[model samples]
Target: MGKKAAMQKSKQWNVKGAMRLTSVFHFLQSCGSGCLVPFLTLYFRHLGLTATMTGIIMASKHLLTLVWRPVSSILARQYDKRRTVIVGSLLSSALVVLILLLFPSAGTKAESGRCNASQPSADFTDGSDFTTLESMIIPSQSNVTVYSVNHTTVIMEQPDDLNSTYTPTLVNSSSNWSRRAIRYLRELKEQQEESLHTEFLGSLKAMDAQHQMFFLVLIVIGLWEFMAAPLEWTADDGLYEYLDFVDATDRHKGVTVWKPLGTAVGNGVVGILVTSLYCRTGTVAEFYSYTAFMILTVPTAALLPLYIRKRDRPTSGGFKALQLVHRNSQALLCAITVVLTGIASSAVSDFLLWHMQDHNATEIHMGISLALAHLSQAGFPLYAGHLAGFLKYHGWLLVLAVIALSIQCLYYSFLWDPWSIIPAQILAGFSTGALWWSVAAQCEDIATPGTEETLIRLFEGLPLELGSGLGSLMAGFVMQKFGIKILFQGISVILAVWSITLAALKWKIPRQRRINYSRLLTADTGEISESESDQEKDWLETAMEDDNQKNNWTIAKS
Candidate 1:
């Protein structure tokens, strides 16, 4: 009896130790990822990659999540190297990023900085475009405004709609130009920033080096992203499983909260660092901080348990989850809503920072806004139950999420100043939090006996990733062709329409609540129900285990 008590004490100690270690690892990894991810668009832009190319790369990363996580899960279970994989991924990613920093093409945009000058023409009365930041340095002497950055001359093409395009080009100083005297129409440069000799799209000949560099970057970053998603999945799953085995699932919330706290802190700090570096020497701080944070994470990750915690019950595969969804009309409706939500979610993720910067948001402002985004949903989780009860069903809550997304999109469309982004991010975070719970609870409701994890995965995994990837690609093309404002405005309209349709469908479909068999997750393969009326009811229903019971698995960081 004394030995048994000692064993119990030791197990208790292990649970406490695991929680502490898990929290530290989560914080460190999240901090590193926070610094790394939100600014990828900025880095890609700096590399002179077109918006379309950048979009493709971002989309590829999201899509790769489905492939990488399953493979890593297999490796982890087979090899029993969860800790090794996590630490190794952190180290390997740092190395890849450092090597990527050595590329020379990121400097090309800064080499000949381009801005569309509204005042270049004498007839243009409005200087509203230059209200805050000036990407263009208008020469005091020359009537002909060729684009220049640091006195380097660049070829310019005037667009019929300047708002539609922003191809950064620089102007040459008047003294460096050997100009033949034109007797007529010398005032053309003053009237327009376009050159008649050049095409509206400009020459693609010079972008060869940039294109090659971007392709290489695309390949490298895609691989990096492929490795990245799995590590996060492994880490989070490992922690949850650890907590489950120890019967310490109650501590899950306390531990996972650190991720957002770390994200908020790291994002804000890195933004300041980037701004400081950019002001002094025009450097991107994410390159340095990202590597450092990853390295810092190595020790923390190493301390996390290397072993996988085996669950007692057998869970159904994704096939059974799909079968359930096919049988249930409300589940089908909710699944469709999740996909549309994912697509809308991608627009803000890929381009909000870019949009903020376009309107003169400094790195600090963008960072704070992003940090706020992580924390915005923090309080919402507390009210998850209340919100669902008040709305009377998870389906309505999901419809509300779609509506929240639309409202956020509309806000983003009208945003002009940097400070306004904070509230916008807050709204995004809350809506996303609402969406996660609503989906999780609803998915749980529709899941029959065996399809718990599969149902959540169906709602949360590849479908969402697929939607986000496609959305990123679409956003890039739209923003590139029409401008960021138009992109947001159009998306807002689409979301608004979807939200209305979703609400109507949800209203028509009655909510169904399955008995909470998952809560009885136990080691008994003897019977799913310690007591149940029908055996056929439980034939499809087995103990799915605590792992599948995890709600809030989707869009936790939105």
Candidate 2:
């Protein structure tokens, strides 16, 4: 009795601790994301890369993330989720620090000084005697040859002390011919200086060997990012898993309310900190500080699982259940929606900094914009979740997402000032926050028992990986070709078409007929017992007999 009571008390302690730990973990993770991710495009631009190149780099990371999704899922299952999160967070942080150390800043103090001192001198003199001026100017109309005896090409200046009788014999030897020639020489020298400056500036703008090194470092960073992709989804999945041990009401409260609330607070705090740091020191210094914070938080995040009991760890099924998830239609459709949502979100979040910066937004404005968006994100999930419950069809929640996205696109289309962009994020926040909560809950609803983590990861990671990857690439190309406004318009159109199609499909099929969880188990698992099979057959036969009886009754009445 003593041992049993101790075990029960331990379980109670774990339950309470797990809830708080999940919230704290999400908060820290989001803090890091808010500080670094939104500014990445601008960071690349700071490093002298073009929009297309920045997109390519971001796309590469997402592509690697897609490749890593399955691997991360397996790793999470094979080990503790806490272990996976810890290692991934630490490695990602280390890579960020390494990248900063490996690559020098794009514009260094010495290089700036060199660029300044390399300016062409205004006085065009070679400190040579002008007695041979007549020898330098050809008499023929073919060409004027200015020879330099010491290999120093002197500018041809007409001597003001030249005797009026000593007119030089030259082509078109008018009285003012020497003056015209001197004027032409000065113009040529000025042109050369301008060309030199232009070349120097172009060199600064163009990608070179150092830029290639930066690109290579980014690829390495992507590899590190691949490891971190599963952390967010894992937290959500783990929380849902914890719900199995707690009251059902906590599921709604924990997921919709607490999780987003924590994320909002973290994002808001980080936004303020980022704004302050960026205003004082600039982006590079701010990035370094953020990375340091991320590194320190990894250990804090790792402490979560220590408080979680073994019974609270997420259950995993073998590879067979993993295969079963793919055949589940509800899961498939949910995954597709998530993918589309990811594409839309990535296009905006990844490039919002660049978009606002184009409109002359200061760092403080950018931080406030992101903070406000996250705050909206924090507040809306519970309401959106409640609204989803109020509506008969959960699928309509997606339609709401589509509407929110459309509003954001419409608002951004007309926004000419940076601060004006902040208000648009209200829609963005609702769209993204709603989609995230809805997709997770929907995936949980459809997940096979013991395969919850696997399905959640698939639903969360795969769609986001592919959508964000493709979206970043597309956004880069579109923005480069047309502009930011056109890109948002195009995204809006695609989303409109997609949402219409989804709505039509949803309308055609009643929600009750959409997914039969028992059917998923029987069709996928092949593990039904004899009694369960017998019960299924009896139920089917009874339904058929009832249909026949009703037909017979109708005939008799007629």
Candidate 3:
């Protein structure tokens, strides 16, 4: 190839390379969520911030996420997804780094000085008085001789113990002043007046450094987020929403709930194990290991793309292809499960250690309860998804789970048994995951056929986030005042009502839509026009060359 042609081909290769790099970059960047989510509170504590202050800070992030969700989506549609992703991730990273640089470290030490014990006081006399007291105590009978010490008498007094003896001095005037008296008073007074200052700038400097490092980590994370938000919002969110939407309904309910179920269970189980280990070890090392486990789970999130891609692979027949896609769709579901389970497990695990009781029975009771809860949760999505798939009423499953959890919580207020709450936890996981899956699946399906081919997926992530956010905020107040049981009961009633409304709407809404497939398709894929045009141009050029070669051969033969 000529240099120009080679350069053009290289440019095309670079474009492909850029696309591949984007996915990897996004995956690495998203790890920030896992990293920060697990340790925000710990970070604040290290900075000597109070629990209340930490809570406020964390709450601020949640609030921002909620407010920005819709706004971010709108922005994504208005601009290029790639630019948004890169810019958002970078911005967030920068913010995190800046915060690190400015944050104050709490470990600075204060300066202090030593006290002198040998200073003369009002009870003691001048040199003559010391000699008099010595003489009085040593009446001339003993072999003791009172020496007239010269210059100053420097007595290095040790700090007194209770067993030590005490004595007093008496002073008397002599006809002529002794040189010893002048020196003793002058020397001792001079020594007493002198002071030693201990500077502790070293400690202050060390603390500053620590704080800077801590803040830098967070700032780097936040700035990197600037790059992520654009891609996530423009591309991922739509697909996520679609998956979640479909999972919420019967159409895509079969394997969609798997991911959420896995997540709740994974989180609970891992958390329980971590707490137990930490309790035994009684060291922060256990906490670090727990953190490591969470960090390691980032790869799980990245696997979703693989599952989605697998579904898109060529097949021998249309029916078989659909079957394969449907089957592999479960992989995405499973990934979602792992993501949630990992997070919840870590949280619950920490909760156990934080509030564990010393009583032997209490420990056993809590552990058993948590285990049952996790196990029940592990199987919940399977059952819920089955129901959703069979009945074609996935939203109701969410309602059902919510109702069950509320009832159990209410029951706890009236009665007590850790194990009894296990069912509720399981149901909660099922309902939440299934509800989310229903919505996500719907979004994916609803997009026009061509667009769907190029596009983002749907997910219940939004509703889940919204629901959980409300639930968390309320749970805190209810548990603090009315108790855990009352809170659950209240939520159950609310969910039941909502579930009924959704069931009624199932048949009323359109199952399909009529649209210009091409337009919808454009939004689904990467700058579709540019990419498609380039691809078409390349293919046409290749075809034209082949035709020309065929004509040339025919002419030569003739």
Candidate 4:
């Protein structure tokens, strides 16, 4: 998630102010996102949302990406409104957090699963107290008697408080003692029955209250996500636009590194604050910190680039991208890989916290866990190009991602304590970034000359979102029905099978290396030039053919 991805690096921006402002912008974005995103499931649990409900809410982030990203991109391109979109999104999203904090239904309430014993009512008259021989059977429940004495039973329930006193019916000279006992027993029965009814009604009301807040949060958070969606790609698009304008496109990593750095720092700091301040579930600290960081992001948002990159020709359409994937085997593999990877990653992101929480994990631990994942994920892609270029590790990346995710699933399947889980969190971004790298590299290598843009759109866009949304839904039900351990174990098995299948595919249909094997092997700086990689592919192929021919000749002579 921390990875700004395989998009081209922007040229360096020489202006000091622009660089400073963009750095600050990236920092705040990461800080705000990292501080609270990992703990959101815990927040929902504190608010009494069911596991399935939380899944739907988390899944909305991905599914809704389908709707908002294009809208943001179109507006940014057609109207040159990147600044407007990012600022508006931050403010609107901040407002949504504020609303959730203030909304009463969103606050903590009595759990419906709690057990509350109803009080017992009893009364004894003081006037003319001569009645005696009033034998009582076992205390009655719901007006049913366990024993009777002389065709009458005077059963009295004890109060919950042990200090409360009960008056015994003494011997009576009055003939109406039986009538009095009967009357008093009837009153006690009626009172107990009334109390039971009241409790039943109260429970129903509490359940209604739980459901009311659940739906309210669902709608509000969905809207919040919809508003916030543009902040991801739209803001970067603007920054890259400015970089293109100033011929600083190569400085993309320099400007974008702030997001992951800030996010990592924010997570660690906020987690500590939550721990020290006792900002437990249903608390205000997480939301407050998020709102503050987002508010800080506003000033930086003002200076970001908003100009659209002017294209002289029309790019390939979305439909054309699908047509390419349909015809190309590697492209088809990329699409499937992204989708399945999205599903596994989504399930882990959405519900693994719930699993940790079950083992007594707190916000701080989750924060650090997420911080580690972000740092690890962010670092990989820096060298991913070299690895893919030098060894042509595209197919192997898929294998690594699948196996990494499978290992993660297995680790989580045996999750005992939350602290031990942090180490496993490192795999979180590795698995995702590996798959993204593999798919992106494959799409780039296999695309038709003019259809590169469309091909990129196909693998990165809808398939990931659709898979994420679907995974969340299915995992949610599995978690609620069986348990977290079983759910992850099942996912691990499925991934194991998929990994084997992919291994077989890689064996059967090997992809040609896109980079020159000899040059990268010899470069001292260890820097990979993609341009060089592209130019020398034909040369590498010719050498391979010549070697193969020589091997055949040698074998024939021998």
For candidate 2, the per-residue lDDT at 67 reads 76
Query: What's the number of clashes in each of the models?
Result: 9, 0, 85, 17
User: Candidate 3: misplaced stretches above 4 Å?
Assistant: 1-58, 67-287, 294-386, 389-402, 411-415, 450-462, 501-558
lDDT assessment of candidate 2: 0.62
The 10-residue segment with the lowest total lDDT in model 3: 108-117
Cα shift from native, residue 161, model 2 (Å) = 48
Q: Please, what are the lDDT tens digits per residue for candidate 4 over residues 1-558?
A: 334433223223444556777788889988988777767777787777777888888777678887778677766666767778889998988878667665553433433322222212112322323232322421234222222334433344355666986543433323486456556666765576567656854433333445666767778888888888888678766666566677675675576567777888888988888777662333577788888899999988987755566663353356666765675566666677678877877888888877776777776777788788778776778888777677556667888888888998889888788889876778856686677667767766655444554566567678888888888888888889998888888888988898898878877764544445465465521243424344355556778899999999999999
Residue 492 local lDDT, model 2 = 84
Winner by TM-score between candidate 4 and candidate 2: 4
All candidates: CA RMSD in angstroms? 12.5, 12.2, 20.7, 12.2
Residue pairs in clash, model 1: 114-168, 114-169, 146-171, 147-170, 147-171, 148-170, 148-171, 158-194, 449-541
Model 4: what TM-score?
Answer: 0.70
Q: After TM-score superposition, what is the CA distance of residue 53 in candidate 3 from its true location, in Å?
A: 7.4
Model 1 regions more than 4 Å off: 1-13, 106-207, 250-254, 306-316, 447-454, 516-558
Give the alpha carbon lDDT tens digit for every residue of 366-426 in model 2: 7677777777877775477578878765667877777688678767767788779877877
